[model samples]
Target: MQNIENKVAYITGGSKGIGFGIAKILVENGLKVAISGRNLDDLQEAQAVLGEDNLLVFQSDVINFEDEVNSVKRVIERFGKLDVVIANAGVGKFAPVDEISLDDWNAMIATNLTGVFHTLKASVEELKKSKGYYISIASLAGTNFFAGGAGYNASKFGVVGFTQAAMLDLRKHDIKCTTIMPGSVTSNFADHVPSDSDAWKIQPSDLGEMVIHLLQMNANVLPSKIEVRPSKTS
Candidate 1:
């Protein structure tokens, strides 16, 4: 396993759900992390849960390019170096194609697609210096489309294509890129209430473990893309 001790990770939407889980694992392995989110209260609560001194919280909306740039700068300024970036902030809303409002579609594109671009744009230079890894949290919808998910599918599909192109662009510098597409994760994404309906879904921690495994892979090889789904889905 590659040693991540003393490494610094910048994670968007790290206040809860998948981002928070990944942050916990990285911190446990001796990495210093800066977790960013739109809500300061939630970010602070997450920082408290992760404990003080190891995790730093930054409140910024990933959709804003300037904010993204400043947040990356802040992370490097505070931590001295940045090794990994996880673009995990996203939103999902279900609606029929004809019923989907333009605002909803735009929101999905802004947060899920453009947000990743802004994040990478903000951190690519630092990543190039450290030959770091960039992980984009896409979804199975990127490949497998379904009803009432038109906007989300479009954003995720764009993410899949974007990450692959970025991998090719970054590989020459020894920088790695990975797009993780998970299916039916049990979380409060886009206002979905957690219930027994989510019993068979994958947990946030499972994705965190996947991240650890990917980061631990030999530097000589890059997996590039990983598709994760529940073993028992109806």
Candidate 2:
């Protein structure tokens, strides 16, 4: 297992949900973590909980490539180097293909698909320097289509495809890329409040542990694509 102590990681959408979970775990395991989100209040709140010693918070929107570039620069400035990048920022909108509004579809595609590209593009050079790891939080919807999930499905499917191709491209440089496709995570995705009713779903912390496991793997081993679901369905 590779030692992750003192390595630096930048997680998009790290203010809450899966990103926050990953940031928390990475910090506990002795990593310097930078978390970015568009919401300053939420970012500050997360910094308070995660503490100032190992955490840096930035207000960034993934839809803008410039924002991502600046974020990577800031991470490097604060932590010196970035060894991990998690493209976990995403938004979901569910509607029938015919009924989905242009605004909603564009929002999903821009934030979920294009956003991943921007994040990776902005950080690839630093990752090459560190021979690091990049992980994107995709979704089971990428592979499974549902009645009202046209927009969401398209975006996640793009994420899965993009990350897989990126994995192939980055491996020769000794950089590892993986897309984690999760099902029914208990998060505030799509404005749904997490509650006891979500007990059967996968938890954000569960995914966090998965990230740590991947980071600890031998350099020669790479689980390029992973599909994770809850053991029991609600």
Candidate 3:
């Protein structure tokens, strides 16, 4: 219903799972999308799945500042303007507090929190020009802590804090910011994918549809923080 026929969106971690799912739906809704991943092979495969006409693939690491900038540059060059940006790339390594390594903690922070900063920094000007939207895919772990998830929690909680502040700062520019938190999504998260044993888990498409729903919301109102969970968790 919301017409995005010419709007351009850039989604990171889009080779598979929730990122790719959102990319697919955005394309179906007539938005031009640029999807990024670290692996060229995965990006190519995702491109094929989504059809190359409405989807562009960029192979870049979100943790790398130059690569993130180049990705935004490429999208602007191709689409002329960027109307939306989703910082959906993330990584997690679970370990008890005493067992967590510095490398693991840094990786979580870099990709989950700093990666988002890079994403917004790279695209902020275009978003200001177009009065666009920015969304970050955080996690329930951000608000609800659990053991062995300290690093992940820290990153996501930081994402929530950062995006909320950004929302305040960017509102005057007419650029919206939102943080989406989901629980137990059925993905290759921590190397676990959907299976019969996981029939009740939240599918990536569910979150994909949510992204579409958020985009279609009336411009006058902002859904700043959305918390999503499976309705019938067993």
Candidate 4:
């Protein structure tokens, strides 16, 4: 297992859900965490819950390339280095292929696919410098197709593909890249709010633990792509 103590991590969409869960765990494990979102209020709320120690908040929108780049710089300036990045911010727009509006499709592409790309492009240099890790939070939809999932599926599929290729490109530099594709996660993603009814679904903290496991794994091994799901479904 690699020593993650004192390493710095940047997590997009860390205000809530899986990203927040990951940040919570990383902080507990002695890594400095910087979480970014577009809303200052949400970031502040997260700060209250996650505590102030080893935490930095950046109000960044990953869809904007410059925003992502500046965020990288800001975090580096505050923490002096960046060792891990989790591209966990994503949006979903579900509709039949024919009924999917252009705006919805574009929004999914921008926030889910292009945003990951921008996050990576902005942070890759720092990762290379630190010989760090890059993790993209994709979805099982990247490989599965269903009615009314056109836009979401396309964006997630793109993320999985992009992250895999990035793993190949980055391994030579000793920067690990991975994509985590989850199924039926209980979170406030899209129209779903997690509740007792979603107990059968994977929990946010479970996903966070997965990232922790990856970080603790031997550096010679990489679970480049991982698919996680609920143990049982009703």
Q: Which numbered prediction scores highest in TM-score against the true structure?
A: 2
Model 1 vs. true fold: TM: 0.96
Local error of candidate 4 at residue 114 (angstroms): 0.6
What Cα-based lDDT does every candidate model obtain?
0.92, 0.95, 0.91, 0.93
The digit string of per-residue lDDT tens for model 2 on 1-234 reads 999999999999999998998899999999999999999999999999999998889999999999999999999999899999999999988778899999999999999999999999999999999999999999999899899998999999999999999999999999999999999899888888889999999999899899999999998899999999999988
TM-score of candidate 4 against the unseen true structure: 0.98
lDDT of 3 by residue, 1-234 (tens): 455677899999999988988888888888999999898988989888999887789888989989889999999889899999999999989999899999999999999999999999999999999999999999999899999999999999999999999999999999999999999788877777668876687788888788888778888889999998888877
TM-score of each: 0.96, 0.99, 0.97, 0.98
Considering summed lDDT, which 10 consecutive residues are worst modelled in model 1? 188-197
Question: Which residue pairs clash within candidate 1?
Answer: none
* True-structure lDDT of candidate 1: 0.92
> For candidate 4, what is the lDDT?
0.93
lDDT of 4 by residue, 1-234 (tens): 788899999999999988888888888889999999988998999999888879999799998999999989988998999999999999888889999999999999999999999999999999999999999999999999889999999999999999999999999999999999999888888867778998888888899889989998998999999999899985
Report the candidate with higher TM-score, 3 versus 4: 4
List model 1 lDDT by residue over 43-112, tens digit each. Answer: 9889888987878898989889999999988987899999999999999988999999999999999999
* Candidate 4 pairs with clashing backbones: none
lDDT of 2: 0.95
